[model samples]
Target: MEKERREKEEREEKERREKEGREKKKGERARRKRNREWRKRERKKGERERKIKEKKRERKKGERERERRKRERRERRKKGEREDREKEERREKGEREERERRERERERKEKERCDEGERERDRERRKRERKRGERKKAEREREESEIGEREREKGERERKIKERKKGERERERRERERRKKKEERREKGEREERERRQRGERENGREREKQ
Candidate 1:
């Protein structure tokens, strides 16, 4: 009986151990399935986070590109304004130089006209002086000619008066000589007549006494 009881006890023990081992294997399979499900969830969450980070980085890069384009446009506008201002200044300077040249030309022309007027006045004064000198010379020559003519007339009158006085003196001398000759001839003829009368009377007396 002891031996049979012992064999029975051993079979029961073996059965119990076999049942415990099966239960333990079933729990281990349940634990391994839970772990696989949790790992799958974690992997899906990591993929979602990486996609969000990549989208944020792309948006930041686009903003940087827009800022760079804006700066370039501003610089180009400033350069264009500077070029326009320089062109305007050059145009103003050229106009100022042209005005100065025109003013100088006008002044030169005015000076030339004034000099010509002075020369013309000098020529007129000289011509007037020559005419005055010629008139004075003509007057002096006429006066000299008149004086010479008067002197010739006075000389002719004196010569005529001297010739008339000489003729009157010769006629008076001839009249005195003729009167003396007539008086002498009358006295001689009267003396001769008286002598003839005396001789005739003496002859008559002598004849009477004789008778």
Candidate 2:
């Protein structure tokens, strides 16, 4: 009996020891799994931080480029303004010179006009003098024509005096003939008067018949 009890006790002790060993191995495995998971999480956090830093660097570079571009644009605008001002100044100067030239041309034209007017006045005076001289010559010619007409009248009177006797005989014959013509013209006039009186009497008879 005592030997059986000792063997059994020994067997129980061995089983207890084996169970403890199995539990220690399970705890160690769980600890190693937790450590691996923690390391993975730390690696992920480091990657996120690196990405954020890179993004910030890119944004800073973009901002600096934008500033540089803006500065260059401003400088170009100022330069363009300066060029425009210079062009305007040059245009104004050219305009002033043109005005001066125009003034000089106008003055010269005015002087030429005055000189031409004086010359025209002299020419008009010369024309007027020539017209006066021509008029005087025409009057003298008309007076000479009048004097010749009077001399012709005197010659005609002297010719008449030389032919007075013969003219008297011809005059007697012409007077006899003129008296016969006058008697015939008087008879014709009396016949015309009688015809007019007959026409008036016929017109009155017609008027009486109508009435």
Candidate 3:
């Protein structure tokens, strides 16, 4: 009986060890499966987060490109407006300069015309004055010639009268020689009368020349 009891206790211990080993093996296999499923879910979640980040980055890049294009367009518009304004100003300046040049030319032409007119008037006045002077000189010369001719004729007539009177006095003296004293006294008185007549005639001639 002691040996039989000892074999039965050994067999029971062996059965208990085998049962505990089987339970441990079953728990280990379950834990391994749970770990594998957790790893797979984590991988899927990581992939989804990566895709979301990529989409956000693409949207931000598009916004930046659009902003750059808008800035370029605004700058181009401002430049075009500035250029147009400058061109207009240049055109206006050219027109103003042309107007001023035309005005100056007109003033110059007017001044030339006025100067020409004044010169023409001066020439006409000088010509008239010269003609008047020539006419007066011709008149004066003609009057002097006429006066000289009249004086020469008067001198010749007086010389002829003196010669006739001398011939008459010589004839009278010869006829009265017989009446001596009376004849001499008559001759002296006649000579005195003749001298007085000659002096009066000279005085009359001098008065005429002065007049």
Question: What TM-score would every model get versus the actual structure?
Answer: 0.39, 0.41, 0.44
What is the lDDT of every predicted structure here?
0.59, 0.71, 0.68
Q: Which stretches of candidate 1 lie over 4 Å from their true place?
A: 1-12, 87-211
**What value of lDDT does candidate 1 attain over all alpha carbons?**
0.59
Top model number, TM-score: 3
In candidate 3 the C-alpha lDDT for residue 194 amounts to 91
Measure candidate 2: CA RMSD. 67.6
Model 3 Cα displacement at 58 (Å)? 1.4
Task: Name the top lDDT candidate.
Answer: 2
In TM-score terms, candidate 3 sits at 0.44
Clashing pairs in 2: none
Per-candidate clash tally: 0, 0, 0
Scored against the true structure, residue 59 in model 2 reaches a CA lDDT of: 82
Per-residue alpha-carbon lDDT of candidate 1 for residues 37-64, written as tens digits (9 for 90 to 100) = 6875886687579758866876786577
**Residue 72 error for model 3, in Å?**
1.2
